[model samples]
Target: MKSLGSSCSSRAAAETPEASRERRAGRGALWSAWPRCAPRDLAFCMAALLLFCLGSLFIQLNGGPPKVLLELRNYLGESTYLDDHGPPAPKVLPFPSQVIYNRVGKCGSRTVVLLLRILAERHQFNLVSSDIHNKTRLTKHEQVELMRNISTIPQPFLYTRHVHFLNFTRFRIEQPVYINIIRDPINRFLSNYFFRRFGDWRGEQNHLIRTPRMKDDERYLDINVCILENYPECSNPRLFYIVPYFCGQHPQCREPGVWALERAKQNVLENFLLVGILEELEDVLLLLERLLPHYFSDVLTIYKSPAFWKVGNLTGTVKKSMPTLEALQVLYRRMKYEYEFYNFVRDQFHLVKKKIGLKSLLPISSHEPSFLRELTLHTPDPLEEEEEEVEEVEDDAKNWLVQP
Candidate 1:
């Protein structure tokens, strides 16, 4: 019986070791299969993830979405569906893909357009330059048609034309980013006056070809006589040229007064991305590069290149002559609103330059009345020889007929 009891105890002890090993192995398997976590800990982790997601959504709503996210969204939005069961997905390009340059004539537009030709190829953006240069003011129907036409252009396109400001918001269409350039009002007038009569380096007969109907006397009209004697060409409304480009197609825009001036200034503030000064063209290009890098990247470099300069030199008006100081004073007094608008744009441009850490090559005095003095300094030297080109006066005969 003692031997039997001892054998049973030994057998139980040996089974106990095996049973313990099996239990330990089961516990290890359970641990490996599923991680153990306290209910509170799991809840905290879930709450933290939810909070992070909510914060990201809030940021995306308040601030604009990050560029990476925008690109991703665009990609997803543009992705093709494998199944042809549903309509194709809509594509939303990043902002400022559609740009409009309602170019004001003789404001270094030709030069900018020339540069854009090169940029369009390099950057792979569509450049739609309108051939219609003369007609700026358009009828309401014409505006709607033109707007629709412009909207149909493919994504990431820049459309340029010598047209007045068209209010896209008025037509319930998406507004495109607007850009333009303006020069000193008097300087612009002088440049146009000469350019029309002597049509750059294209040829001596370029002016006649442009304005075939222009009488020899009208074509050869003197700048001083035009301003001092109140020639219809140099008169009001006709002189009120640049403001209309910004003031939209309103009839009052053609009038030379506070209403037109104010509307133009407001448009410039609200719509235009940039309205550069022709006098500081290099600085303008720099600003354009900084502001709209996609369209104008390396534009400054291209402008400074030897090839661009060779092309630019050909476009300089052959017989540009500055008006006499008396005539300039007269012209200045006549274009009071024009100068005011010019000064306002200049101030705004300078502010932007300062914001972007660009130093102006020419220091502009703070005094408002120094425009005539500054004009004298900035105006091109009088050319001794006469060359023929079409003038705005001959084409815009009806505008001059209207009494101011």
Candidate 2:
């Protein structure tokens, strides 16, 4: 029995050693195989990981956004009004032409600037523009300074400034024709009020004031105190007309009377050369063609092209209304002068059209799609695909005159 037990123990010990050797050999084989295939295996894993991350990012980015496709038939990504290829060389208007562009704000000023700049570039005309954002009222000293500077400007300079009238200190241009652009007063005032209220545009920053101060009487009070008195920027007593500012008078009057309106009308009749009524924009252009016949052979052609506001191309709505209706009404009342002036101007324009027998030449109503109307209203083109549409039109660029 002792001999058999010893033999069994020896046999078990020998089997254990063989089994250990087999296990170690299997592990070694597996480790060696991994190294040989490591490059391809790692590459596959990394590729899969990268693709998964990219897919997640894409889904997150396009998940949610407001879609307003008012009129974007050819909206290839984010295109512009100026054709990438640009227009042909424009016919040149003479230099030294005293142009009083009565720029009405929010009427398509930017487009006008671009058009003027483009035309200047093509025709080698001088272009100079003034920054009205800071100082609406240019002092006599400032005017002198501006004139002195104007003499030094290079040829073909497109000169523009925020001016109420043309009092060029040193300009010696011949038959200097003044140009004024007019729009519906209600629309113009509303646009100006809203743009100042909501958009990031540079103009009057604050909508609320404890008091409104007038521009005329600011000499007696500080800005804070004047606002407390509810004085408007111009210290004139009453809101009567838009032309008072241009006529070298205070925007607000010290006394409320009809004289302010009469004075403004006198200024318009005497000072302005060509008042382009925006209500009769197409007719205005035709008038310009007749007035500047020596320079504008293709007045309609150039006007039909993009000038200001890129009519059909404009997409977004400028912030016009505030949170409360009462606030809006108050602003309208404050700007009542604009409404009065607008009606007066429209009436004058109608009288002129009647006098000249040009009433038949006016563009069709808002519904009509005559080529000229398309240019003035900026009605957008219909989108070919399933997206929103916006109407776009060409502009004669009266808005630039109004903008600061």
Candidate 3:
């Protein structure tokens, strides 16, 4: 009986070891499966990282999305100031003024907006605006909505801010006189370059460290992508992509497609007006005073820059020659169509200014264009008399007046 009991105990002990081994094998299988599962896990992690980086980059680029986000958040619940609860119905903005700010990046757009806001406080015009700040890349629907909203606002609007040329398409009923301000493209581009380059370094520590080297082929996609992340719905026609749209090129051909494109183009010309502030701010102001008599009575306030306030008339002195012959040609090839379009708009503006008696309001100097003089006046042609001559006083002692 004792031997039999010992045998049963031994059999049970042997089975226990086998059970433990099976459990160990199951754990080993789980470990082997880890590498196969790791990729999905890594993908999720990588996507999260990209989103974080993009968000950070956009905030840095746009100069604090935090403030804008806060404003938007507040606005979401209270759709309009004219909504039910007596927040003062959006009345006809008393001033019969239209806003046509030719916004160059980093060229005092914010200051202009602030200035307009301040002016609004003092004046009684209704504040009419779509006010889509930091929205540089927009779909057609959004553009339509923005115009539609602004169109309904009774003028003269007390104030509108952050509006661009394309926004004039909404108003069929009331046509407001257009006003805009422009800076030299070169100066504007340089200012924008430095602004993005330095602003990120100072504020956020290499957040915008990816400053794109200026390209020759007119490819600005690198910079455009950076700017677009933040301003997803901006319809600024001045941007590189929108140039095609503004010119009535593809996607905006005015055929079976959208009338929005054609409307936007005309509004940029007729409804939108720009004062070339780059050439002469004072002259531009004088013109503005004449045109916007209701808004300007005495000397209008000028916005002073915090930095570079006393910087001399550096704008003219800083001459940027075209990148290189090869580069210039390449760029011309890529952007010739848009360049022609821009020139067309520029000529139209010139004509409009002349008709309105605002030509003198533009800055004119006796100083001739040095580059033009060098290019046109001094070009040496083979047909012209050769300036280089070698005198031949021959080996002969006596020289007669002889024609060789």
Best candidate according to lDDT: 1
Residue-wise C-alpha lDDT for candidate 1, range 1-404, written one tens digit per residue: 57988998887787877798898999999989997799999999999999989979987788876788789979888645745447766765646899999999989899999999999999888899999988898999999999999999998999999999999989999999899999888878888898888888858888878888888899899999999999988978788899899999999899999999999999999999998888789999999887888889999999999988989777777788767656866786788888888889889999889998988877876333343545445545544452122233222322332324
lDDT (Cα, 0-100) at 101 in candidate 3: 46
| Displacement of the residue 280 alpha carbon in candidate 3, Å | 3.1
Top candidate (TM-score): 1
TM-scores, all models, native as reference: 0.70, 0.47, 0.43
Ranking by TM-score: 1, 2, 3
- Runs of candidate 2 exceeding 4 Å displacement: 1-96, 151-158, 166-176, 200-241, 249-259, 293-299, 306-312, 315-317, 321-336, 354-357, 360-404
For model 3 the local lDDT of residue 83 reads: 64
* Rank ordering of all candidates by lDDT, starting from the highest: 1, 2, 3
Least accurate 10 contiguous residues by lDDT in model 1: 386-395
Backbone clash tally (model 3): 14
Q: Which is the better candidate, 1 or 3, if ranked by lDDT?
A: 1
Clashing pairs in 1: 196-389, 196-390, 197-388, 197-389, 198-388, 198-389, 207-389
Query: Among all windows of ten consecutive residues in candidate 3, which has the lowest summed lDDT?
Result: 390-399
lDDT of each: 0.84, 0.50, 0.46
Tell me the TM-score of model 2.
0.47
